[model samples]
Target: MPKSRKRKATVPAAPPPPRRPRPRMEYRARSDEAWYGARVVVQDGWLRVMFENSTEDADEWYNPGADFASLGDVEALRARFRRECPPLDHARCGDVRPGDKLCLACDIHGDVEELKYYDAVLETVERAAHGVEQCACRFTVRWTEGPRSGCLDKVGIEVVCCVPKSPIQDPVLSEFLDDLTKRFAEDQGTATAASQQADPTPMSEEELCGVLLSLKRAPNSSTGKP
Candidate 1:
């Protein structure tokens, strides 16, 4: 009689690996940006990121210990850029409508808490995290399941990546903010000269000296005090 052929076992395709976790801070910042103008109703364990209607239709849940920055953060960042550079306009306003791609950003930081060991080391060897666990040990041991290792103390971070605002700044938003700043000498010279020529009143020496002193005291201020 002919020998019976043995059936071969078909191997299954491996499932795709899970995605890397984002840092905690990063998660906060994104949540903040996404619900910028939304009527965020934070209650219980979840947060509701809402639309202008203040209804529950559009919302997202956020857990505790997460950071969520509103549009205010973008404005603050822009303000800093403007102050430092002075040549650009760094103010961001709600003038930007929905669907418009405006500048955005966030920040995150993480620190691992507990150590994880191999499934089989006591599969006793303590976990040596390398991106993802990718090794098998020589010996076998009873394995207590520990948290899967990587960096568990995730921090999701974000920052204003980019934005489009004032028409005057259409040319360069990524460029140094000072680039959009008004060239004082070029911009105000004509007006100053014309005003000086047509002026009906000229101040006395003491008055002029006082004005100079006030200007010197608050050089950075938009208006002189004292």
Candidate 2:
């Protein structure tokens, strides 16, 4: 009769080490003097965003559904742009250098500024409505209405509602820019007319500052995009 050997106690192997979380790809704004967000554009029929960095080298096209871990790595991002995006003709980018306090490319058509403002407002709303139920985000931009031709006229914005998602059109942002551009055109026209009659009185620095302050206080509608 074979004696049964004592069964050894089975030991469970330790579970594999938990995976390290992937770093979130968040690029900060260029500078306090500049817009509080990145400059985005639709170039060559592709959505692209000019990183808010102190260099033109970070400009690259973006995929709405693609992963952006590369954004955290500048060199890697540039390489990706070189491989994927259109050539840097400077025709669309203009002379916008990080050296100046202004972004020439963004300011060329004035759409970038509006987009930047929209981005800032969105951030504010998020911060204020954090952890609160029934909080809604509303960002709007004009579609198919701007100079410089092409699809640049059609504006789109990156919107965040409940969960994070890709860019979408927001009527608020759209109306804001639309009204702004319309007023600008009217102001320019008036300025021209006044100039022909007499030296147009430019708004004083204080008055200009006031106007700008009001813009910064753009009303936030208590609604979310559907």
**Among all candidates shown, the one with the greatest lDDT:** 2
What are the per-residue Cα lDDT tens digits for candidate 2 across 5-111?
A: 11112465563342322212222222322222234455543445454332455444544235332223333333221111111221222222222111111223344
Q: What's each prediction's TM-score?
A: 0.18, 0.18
* Each model's lDDT: 0.29, 0.32
Query: For model 1, where is the 10-residue window of minimal lDDT?
Result: 81-90
Please, what are the lDDT tens digits per residue for candidate 1 over residues 1-226? 1111111124655633423221111111132222122223346634443332223533454443343243343343233221111111223221222233322211122212211111111222222223222322111133222233222221111111223233322112223223223333344677788888898577899999999998777756655543
TM-score of 1: 0.18
Backbone clashes counted, model 2: 6
Which stretches of model 2 miss by more than 4 angstroms?
Answer: 1-168, 199-226
Q: Model 2, 76: alpha-carbon shift in Å?
A: 25
